[model samples]
Structure formats: C-alpha cells, structure tokens
Target chain A: GAGVSQSPSNKVTEKGKDVELRCDPISGHTALYWYRQSLGQGLEFLIYFQGNSAPDKSGLPSDRFSAERTGGSVSTLTIQRTQQEDSAVYLCASSRPGSNEKLFFGSGTQLSVL
Target chain B: SQQGEEDPQALSIQEGENATMNCSYKTSINNLQWYRQNSGRGLVHLILIRSNEREKHSGRLRVTLDTSKKSSSLLITASRAADTASYFCATDVRRDKIIFGKGTRLHILP
Candidate 1:
C-alpha cells in the first residue's frame, strides 16, 4: 500500500461487545504504532511494533485492550468487553526505522460503544 | 500520556495571515515534528527539526526548535483556507517512542 490503511472507518457497537480494528502499514516499513484519540483530546499511545521483535505494549490502556502485528505487515487491535469510555478513533502509523522518522498515518477507525 | 503541550488551543485567522503555534515538552528529545489533520482524517507530516538543528523551512512552513528550553514553534506563513485544520507537535525522545501534544486548532477564514 502507498500509505497506512485502517479498516471499518466507523464502528458502532454496544457496550460489553468486542470489537476488532485492523491496520495495514506501508510496505518495507519496520515501525508501526497504535494510538487512541478521544474527542478533542490528544493521542494516547497504545503499542508499537518494530519488525518482528517483541511489541511495545506498555501503552495498552488495560487488560481488555490487546494488539498484534502479523508477518510485520498487518496489525489488529482487539478490545474485549468494551466500555462507553472506550469509544474513540484508533489510529495506526508506520515509519521507516527511527522514532524521529516521519510517520504515515491511516484514516483511523472511529469505534463508538453505545 | 502526552509528552508535549501546545498553547492557544484554538486560533481563528483570515486567509493570508500567519498562524503560529507553540509546543513545550518536559524531557530532552532527539527531534520534534509537526503534523496537520483535517476533520476526522489522518495526520499529515508537515516538518521536522532535529535536536542539532535550530530552524527549518518547507514551502510556507517554518519550524524552530530550542532544545535548551524544551520548546518548539511552528509558523505557517500566508495561511489559506485549506490550512484550516488541527496542528500537532510530536517529540522523539532518544529514538524510543514518539509522544504527541494536545494540538492547536487553526481555522483559516476566507
């Protein structure tokens, strides 16, 4: 892909339901990141993947939130027993190597838990 | 949590005027970057300034970084209606992780 891609641009699910969001990063990019943004709020880092190494899961909000990057290309974010406060736009970005490298972002998945 | 804070949460300006936004961070950083986002859209990288560099220019955008003060500023000259969007500043600390600010909303009026 020419840029980062996310699936299901908008999602509305009932509270306590599980939701899965997908992301496809650009080819050959070694770094990928997941973030959540509340309305009019700053981005909250969720996780990071560098190649196939151990993912940086330090930012995952809680045990209900988990993510995985398969084959270093596509990634998925899963939220179990979602809460109303969990509603937000989940963003994915990819970069070349270093943290300072420019990040290409996807349009994001707006998950709404009603 | 966010690593940086941006001031003037919102700014409304007429086209052709300059728009400036400031960002301040706590810890030392390797580099700082500026990004723009339209409504419900992904962020677009605008400019980046390395710790070793003080200032950089790209088209109508100018970015300045002061590592000593742990602050940075982005200046958009001759802004246009198309420039109406949310501006964000991200910091890369030691190449570990990238942290973003709350962002400044700029509304360029025609």
Candidate 2:
C-alpha cells in the first residue's frame, strides 16, 4: 500500500462486546504505533511496536486493551468488554528506523461503544 | 507525560495572516515534530526539529525548538483558507514512538 491502511473505518459496538481494530502500516516501515483520541481531547498513546516486540506497553489504559504486531507489518488492537468510555478514534502510524521521527498515519477507526 | 501539549485550544484567523501555535513538553526529547489533521482524519507530518537544531523550515512552515525550555512552536506563514485544520505537536521522547498533544484547532478564514 502507498500509505498506512486501517480497516472498518467506523465501528459501533455494545457494552461488554469485544472489538478488534486492525492497522496495516506502510511497507518496509520498521516502527508502528497506536494512539487513542477522544472528542475534544489530546491523543493518548496506547502501544508501540518494533517488529513483533512491544518495548513499551506502559501506555495501555487498562487490562481490557491489548495489541500485537506480526511480520513487522500489520498490527491489531483489541479491546475486551468494551465500555462507553472506550469510544474513541484509534490512530495508527508507521515510521522508518532513523527517519528523524517522520510518521505516516492511517485514516483511523472510529470506535463507538454504546 | 512525554507528549507535548499545545496551548490556545482554538484560534480563528483571516487568510494571509501568520498563525503560530506553541507546544510544551515535560521531558527530554531527541526531536519534536508538527502534524496537521483535517476533519478528525489521519495526521500529516509537517516539520521536525532535532533537539540540537534550533529551527527548521519546510515551504511556508517554520518550526523552532527551544530544548532548554522543552518547548517548540509551529509558524504557518501567509495562511490560506485551505490551511484550516487542527495542528498537533508530538515529542520523540522514546525510540520508535512519538507522544502527541491534544492539538490546536486552526481556522483560517478567507
């Protein structure tokens, strides 16, 4: 893909349901990141992936949120027992190693928990 | 919080005027970056300034960093109506991850 791609641009789920959001980073990019943004709020870091390993998961809000990356390319963010507070736009970004921190972003998935 | 936070949650300006947005962070960083988002979509990288570099320029965008103060600013010269978007500041505090601020909404009126 020419740019970062994310699936299911919009999702509506009921409370207690589990949801999975997928991210396909730009080809050959070695770094991938997930962020969450609520209405009228700043982006909150959720996770970071370098290859298949996540060096930092400290940002994950709670046990209900988890993510994984495979093949150094696609990544998935899963939220368990979704709550209304979990509703937000999830953004994904990718960057090359030593690219001066330049990141390419995807359109993002708007998750709405009812 | 490694993510930088921008000031002035919103700003409205007339086209052709210069608009400036400021960001401040809490920790040391390797570099600071600016991004633009339109209508709550994906963000577009605008400019980046390394900790050592005081300033950088990209077309009409000028970014300045004050590492000693842990702050950075983005200046858009001669803003256009098309420039209306939300501006974000992110800090490259850790390797492979950048922390992003809430963002400043910019409205450039024609």
Place model 2 in a CAPRI quality band.
medium
Residue A47's lDDT within candidate 1 is 86
Off by over 4 Å in 1: none
Number of the top lDDT candidate: 2
For model 2, the stretches where C-alpha displacement exceeds 4 angstroms are: none
lDDT of 1: 0.90
Candidate 1 structure quality by residue, lDDT tens digits, B10-97: 9999999999999999988888999998995699999989889999999999999998889999999999999999999999754657
Query: When only chain A is evaluated, what TM-score does every model earn?
Result: 0.94, 0.97
lDDT of 2 by residue, B15-99 (tens): 9999999999988888888999998989999988888999899999999999888888899999999999999999877677689
* Alpha-carbon lDDT, every model: 0.90, 0.91
Candidate 1 per-residue lDDT over residues A1-114, each given as its tens digit: 788999999999999999999999999888888889999988888888887653467889999998888898898899999999999999999988654469999999999999
lDDT of 2 by residue, A8-56 (tens): 8999999999999999999999889999988867788888998889999
